[model samples]
Target: MIKFENVYKEYGNGVRALLNINLEIPEGDFVFLVGSSGAGKSSMIKLLIREEEVTRGRILIDDIDITKISKYSVPKLRRNISVVFQDFRLLPKKTVFENISYALEIVGASRKEINRKVDRALELVNLQDKKKAHLDELSGGESQRVAIARAIVNKPPILACDEPTGNLDENTAREIMHSLLKINDAGTTVIMATHAVNIVNELKKHVVTLKDGAIVSNIEKGGYYCELD
Candidate 1:
């Protein structure tokens, strides 16, 4: 579970990015964080990854109070909540398999374990055939799938995406969305921030709309909604 209690975030230049936010995301839930630009979606992603600390209140990931986790434990916390960005963040020089395996290698997993997990991850994204392909050889959607493969290779409990399908066309974007849904179906919590209103309407998952750094609403199995007045 992920919980935010009265969480507030103010930047170094005195710009308030989040205000009195209270949220609770149950385990295995898929959520869409949607709003116009400068709506604090990025700020929430940063806070979740502990890249930015809350000015006040607490953030609990599985009730650990991530706001208070020690420096040495930050990596452990990250492993629990993996993040993916619009940028594929893959090595141009490495094969798809190597890119995903590298994450496990860093954590000192055995080669056999790396192979098994990588295979499974690639399957989850429907890119098993591209394992030996280089980054440049894959299409835009394929690259994103590779990035997703890398993110989930370790089987993390939560995955957060920042504008994941921003660079793709509608068809390609849906492909990316399908990959994410497959991952969510397998029981990992997915919180994605996207500007793709069409995808949001189609998925009809939990939609959390933010505006001016505050959560206006969190609707379950609901399409996009906003206040006009």
Candidate 2:
């Protein structure tokens, strides 16, 4: 489970990124964080990933407080949360298989384990055939799928995606969403920050909308905020 209790995040420039934000996401839940740019969507993602520290309040993942963990311990906290970004940051020199394997290698996984996990992750994203393809060789959607495979190679309990489909077209974005949904179905909690209103309304899962650093709405099976109200 994920919980935020009276969380406040303020920057050195005196900008308040989040204020008194409280939320909870149960295990295996797929949640969408929807809002305009600077609505604190990115701030929430950063806090959960331990990339930024909160000014006040607490964040708990699986009943453990993440706010109190030290910088060195931040890496250990990341084992439970894997992040995917909008840019699909795959290494340019590596093939799909090697790209995914590199993530495991950093954590000191042996060759046998890396191979097995990479194969499974590639299959999950339906990119097993592209295992030998270079990053530059794949299309935008395919590249994002490779990024997804890399993120999930470690089998983390939570997948945090930030504007994953921002660069894809309608059809390709749909494909990426399907890949994410498949991972969520296999019991990984997903917290996605997206502006793809069509996809959000279509999926009709839980949505937590942020406006001016505070939660404006949280709806179960909700449609886009603009269309709903």
Candidate 3:
């Protein structure tokens, strides 16, 4: 389980990005973090991935307090939690297989293991046909699928996505969501931050709404319209 206890985040510029956040996300659950711009959604993601530090309180992943871990252990911690960004941040020149397998390579997995894991990840994202294709050769949705495959190649227990469908059209965005849902079905905890109302309403998943850096509402099977009254 992931737990946030009295979490707070404040920048040096005197901006309070988050205030007294306390949340729990159980294993294999799919959650949507919904909010308007600057609502501290991104700040929460940064804190989860340890890109930023909390000003106060603690964050625990399965009883491990991430807020107090040493800098050297951050990379190891990330192996259990992977992130997919809006930009898709892929190597344009690399083949889909190469891109997804790079994560395993960083940890020095043998070629046999890389191939096995890459194959499984590609299947999970329904991108097996595009394994040999380069990034420029795939459509926007396909590229995002590749990014998802890369994020899950290591079999991380948690996947955090920030504005994953923000760059695609409505149909393409739905396709990307389908892939994400598939990953969630396979038992990975999925936490997504998005502004897509239609998608939120259509899926009717867990929604946590934020306003001015504070959680205003948390609804089971919630829609985008469920913000604080």
TM-score of model 2 vs. true structure:
0.97
TM-score, prediction 3:
0.97
List model 3 lDDT by residue over 31-126, tens digit each. Answer: 999989999999999999999999999999999999999999999989999999999999888999999999999899999999999999999888
* Residues 114-150, model 2: lDDT tens digits: 9999999988889989999988889999999999999
RMSD (Cα, Å) of model 3: 1.2
Pairs of residues clashing in candidate 1: none
Q: What are the per-residue Cα lDDT tens digits for candidate 1 across 35-59? A: 8888899999999999888999999
The regions of model 2 sitting more than 4 angstroms off are 227-229
Instruction: Give each model's clash number.
Output: 0, 0, 0
Candidate 2: what lDDT?
Answer: 0.92
True lDDT of residue 67, candidate 1: 93
What TM-score would each prediction reach against the true structure?
A: 0.97, 0.97, 0.97
When summed lDDT is taken over every stretch of 10 residues in candidate 2, the lowest stretch is 220-229
Q: Candidate 3: which stretches are off by over 4 Å?
A: 226-229
